[model samples]
Target: MSLLPPNKKKVAKETPRNFVIFGETMNGKTYFTEEFPNPINLNTDGNAEMIETPSINISHQRDSKGTITKSVSDVLSDVIDELQGTKHGFETIVLDTIDDIITLFEQEICEGEGVKSIGDIGWGKGHAMLEMMVRVLIMRLKELSMKKKVNILYISRSIDIEENDVSKQVPSLKKKWMNIVNGNSDYTILCRKIGKQYIRKVESKRKNYTRDKIDDEQIASLLDTVIGAYEKSKKTDVKDAKKIVEQQEKQEELEQKAKRKEREEEAAGESTKDNPDPKQDKQPEQAPKEVTKEPEQSKKQPTARRRPPRQARS
Candidate 1:
């Protein structure tokens, strides 16, 4: 680490994406979703016949009064529950015409507020609630895609609307909800019928995840362009990788410091060995030896005296 570094290292990781595919009445929107592996359709529009792939149809439950009605939340909750089951064997989750789900939510809101339309809720509360519901839905779908590791394809019909004095075909959802959906999705695919042939176009492509299992060559080509653009984008991933790199650098620095200290100690020892002190190198002096003497022996006069005394006694 330094005050002025060359550049911040950039890293990228795969992030699973959720897609929104929109088009006209019969421009291959549902068919496009079918290209995904093991797709389970949530037929909100009750138009499963149009989709060639089989789907999981959720029935409207009756209340205590025996009235056949369904709450949007209840239906979505059931789908989430099914997704939680590991034995379900669904690889992808498809929602045909998310516009229908929005309408269902609107109907539920109206029923709760005792109104004929969402506008009747007054003070734009209905719209606020609608946006909230849409946000929740988008968040849950993101969980399904990212946490559950399943691909999500939301199909919706396009509508011709004037935006900033220009008429453009967009997904048939309110502006707020549409913006949220587009922002959350990794790709917004636009399906259009040009002449007798249908064409798929990428309206937006900003995601870290790349979908590779596409059967249609044309659609796959378009997706390749999107993935290439994402690859070229200026993005950085601030994940645990950065932390791991920092830790490795720190460990290397500590090791280098230890090696330098050891070298310094060895050099000091070698200098002491090569340059000796004269005084300490000299041999110690020997102590002086003690002179020892033995006393002279006395003459044997006692023996002469003893012989004279014996002669006198005799």
Candidate 2:
């Protein structure tokens, strides 16, 4: 009665969490991400070298001809490819200082369009393209997280924005892009340095900023506390989990059936094109035959005269 095949039935996996950590420089934003399990940092702002974790430097590449070859966007794509195609023992992938990555995306857009700045592209299309690029990156990472059971952490520098004459600290990103980033992440934490002590803020008292208060402690354990809280929140009974798994299996079966039907339709179309139905093809009709009557009276008279001559001779 199971919807999934015997081999396809699997235990519920631990959901990987996406985190956005932002704070001022030297406030331990990068250092905090290192506390995650087996993290591989994608160095965007050259800050990864300062940490002891394994890191890949993402930047513009130059070819032998002394011309700029690959952009940072291309490098990031390669990194994603590596994660997808290769097997490296990494449980978490960190984007150190997402601000740099955003800037790189802008540069890439400008260079591709032959414009000096993103605004130079008329009709506000450049910003849209940049947002698209960033979203694509985040989506790809999310895919990796699901497929590989890896966590994602985005490190960003904090900036002070004065709105309504009130200063607020937030991630150093454009208002629109910041929303996208925060929306996709499971947790948005602010790291603050308070007199020789670094503390993480999980909740905000004011409406100017958004935060997911996972832990109540002002100084909780780094990665463990976050993961524990997330897991605890999602913890379900065994029967409930099984039901959820069954639902997922049924959905997968439905998707597979749809794909199979699509493939069959495509194959049928191709077959028809290669060898068409004979009935469907218009065959030329032959003209109707004309019927002619024979001269029957002439044959009857010749037979009667022969019979009379034979009788007289007898």
In candidate 2, which residue pairs get closer than 3 Å at backbone N, Cα or C atoms, i.e. clash?
none
C-alpha lDDT values of all predictions: 0.74, 0.75
The lDDT, on a scale of 0 to 1, for candidate 1 is: 0.74
**Tens-digit lDDT string for candidate 2 (197-254):** 8877653221221124422222224544432333333469999999988977986787
Q: Where is the poorest 10-residue window by lDDT in model 2?
A: 203-212
Show where candidate 1 strays beyond 4 Å. Answer: 1-11, 49-51, 58-69, 161-167, 207-314
lDDT score for residue 39 of model 2: 93
Q: lDDT per residue, candidate 1, 88-175, as tens digits?
A: 7777788776888888788778877888989888899998998789889888888877776777788888889654457888888776
Clashing pairs in 1: none
